[model samples]
Target: MTEFRAFHNTDPPQLLKLWHAAGLGRGAAECLSIDAFEVLIFSQPYFDPNGLIVAVEDGEAVGFVLAGFGPNEEESALDYSIGIICAVIVHPNFRRRGIGRELVLRAEEYLKSKGAMNITAGPSGLLSPYLVGLYGGTRPSGFLLSDPLAAPFFESIGYDATRSIRIYQRDLLGPKPPIKFHLVNLRRKMQLMISDDYQAPNWWWLTRLGRLETLHFELVPKTGEGAVASATVIGLDLYIPKWEERVIGLTDVFVKENERSKGYGQSLLLEIARRLQDELITKLEWHVEESNTVASHVALAVGYYQIDTGIVYQLVSR
Candidate 1:
């Protein structure tokens, strides 16, 4: 017999055990420690004990679901209008017994009770409240297609795929990437600045990326006072134990509004790649929404190739 209950203080070890047994996918961190969960999940200021539902069988944990909400429009507070099911994992031996469905159903009820007008499965961009570095490669990029169980499991539970995010990767050891003439000229007039301990500009950014080992890069005019473009890369150290390769994931890429189409974005990306290659990092990944053609073009211009797709889902009747 199995029973469901809210998360308890002593449940991290059990949840970590279930995480290993569930086969979350390549994007998921392997060999995770309790400390990682402490920093990435439990320590978040917005963590709600009731939002994380766990399943117990014979007093052993078998599955869990983590649900939360994104920031409000002002990016200053939680927005209960859009609730997110950030993660759902079930132990392999305990699956096929409706445990996953029950967990999701309970998660839905919890979200609705909290005033959610919309419910989305898997976290992405501003919709993400946690699991930024634990699950997704770069940032929370919805449920990755590489996870064989995600699509079928969510669809069977009445969710429909409503958006797709393309995961792109570039080999740092490969031949030189294509460089446009405008980018070359842009580089001459701009200086590339790199920092390993840069500060977040706002509360929202600090909440999402504050705990990770991030590499920040910016492109600024040689004589200007501010950056025209910037990009952030996070060390995927958890992956190193499993993949045995030095890897970093790109996220929070930005270009000033007035700087768009001036080639600063591509220039900053190429410079970042060059610097990482020199540091012997083997791979870099960037996730872009399918609708963002401009970002896709920038990524492709830097020799990135599509490696996978992440799907974001919602209830059919919602």
Candidate 2:
């Protein structure tokens, strides 16, 4: 017999045990500490005890599901209309017992009770409300296909795949990819500005990335006052033990609307890669929507290769 209940303050130890027993993939932080959970999940201002459902049998946690809401269009506050089932983990020993399904059902009930009209499983982009760096590389990128269980489990539960996320990685120890002759001139014309003191542009940005040690890179034309492109990255020093390499997760890549098709994005990425290489960073990880051809091009132009993919699932209407 199994009992289900909301998370208790004392459940972290049991939950941590269940996490390792569940066999998550490389995208997940394997060496996560209780403090990591506190900073990444429990410490968030919007965290709700009721949003995390825990399954217990023999007075020990066996499985769990975490649910939360994304920010509104303005990124100012939670939009109850949209609810996200961020993660579902069931202990390996408890497999084939329907514990995972029950956990998700309980998560759904919690979301629906909070006025959610549209529900999504597997957090991605701004839809992500928890476990950003802890689960996915750099940012919340749905559920990685490397997990094997994610797609089948979610699809079997009536969630349809709506978006594809491509994870890319570049080894910075090797020589940087060569740039075009035109790009060389462009590089000379633009300044690559790197800074450690980046102020978040908005409340949502602050909420998501505030805790990480962020590095901001901007490409600006020598003659202009505005940046043509910019990118944000955070060091994954905590992952060094698990990955056995120094890593940085790249996110919030952007280019000015008027700067599109002018090679600014590609040049910015190459410069960023070069800088990371010079600093002895071993690897850089980035993810983008599969439909984003421009970003895909930029990443490939800088010698990044697809290392994995993730699927974003949405709950189908009855």
Candidate 3:
């Protein structure tokens, strides 16, 4: 017999045991440290304990799932919700059971109760369909992909795959040819437009991070024209406190279609490195669509290496 319950602070040790037994130690090690998981549960904008479910068999936790609920910035009427099956480990001795599915169902129930019209899992990048349906926006936290079996498991149960993204990292201390482009210094001008009362779906995250003194921005001039054609926003995220103690994170960088091949993206990245280097930052990270060849080339030329892959999955109530 199997039963599911909410995850508690005291479940880490048991959870870790299940994680270790499932041959997922490396993946588990990266995201589920005792301290980090605790912080994730408490630090997120909407973290309901009732949304985190654990599957138990014979009084021991065999699987776990986590879900969060919040308002969708683009679709104010539809509450935004995310359900992550963070750990769905079934003891090697107890494989082929329906415990994982039950845990997922419980998580979905919790999210629905919070007024969520859709639920997505895996990586935020793969959740675009859900985001587009729920928020009418494409912004995702990151990209991730589930295992083949996992993908089918979700699909068989109603989840669909959308897009996948790869996480890339660029080492800042490497020797590279100087990037040449006309730089339009817009820090002072841009700062003037920022305010504590301004709110927008796309800019809300930026505004919140701006309040922390970690947000930075640069505007690039359009090629063949003096007008601004692109903008880049960078910030610092303390997600992985150990591996990336103070890494520079690329918040957003957009180049107009007409601005292609003008080196605007390259210039923006170089300037970001130069500015952050002045402050002693040594690492920079960003996410790129796996299908975007242009962006991939730019990233590679700038010494960035593909490190991790993630997907964002989305679902909307029909």
Best prediction by TM-score: 2
lDDT over C-alpha atoms for residue 100 of model 1: 96
Total clashing pairs for each candidate: 0, 0, 12
TM-score of each: 0.96, 0.97, 0.64
Local accuracy of candidate 3 as per-residue lDDT tens digits, 171-272: 777675444434234322221111234233453343233233334354423333342333333434323432554456664566667766866666567666
lDDT, each prediction: 0.89, 0.88, 0.53
Question: Poorest 10 consecutive residues of model 2 by lDDT?
Answer: 173-182
Give the C-alpha lDDT of model 1.
0.89
Clashing pairs in 1: none
lDDT of 2 by residue, 1-318 (tens): 999999999999998888777777888878778998888889999999999999999999999999999899899889998999999999888887899999998898999999999899888989989987688878878998988899999988889999999999998887678759978988999998988889888787787788778999999989977899999988887677668899898898999997789888888888888888878898899998999988998899888999999888999963
Clash pairs, model 2 backbone? none
Q: Give me the runs in candidate 1 sitting further than 4 Å from their true place.
A: none
Which candidate comes out best when scored by lDDT?
1
Report the C-alpha lDDT of model 1 over 1-318, residue by residue, as the tens digit. Answer: 889999999999999988878887788888989999999899998999999999998999999999999897778889898999999999998889999999999999999999998999999988989898888788878899888999999999899999999999998888777657888888889898888879877677788788888978988889977999998899888888766898899988999998899778788888898888888899999999999999999889889999889999997763
Error of 3 at 251 (Å): 2.0
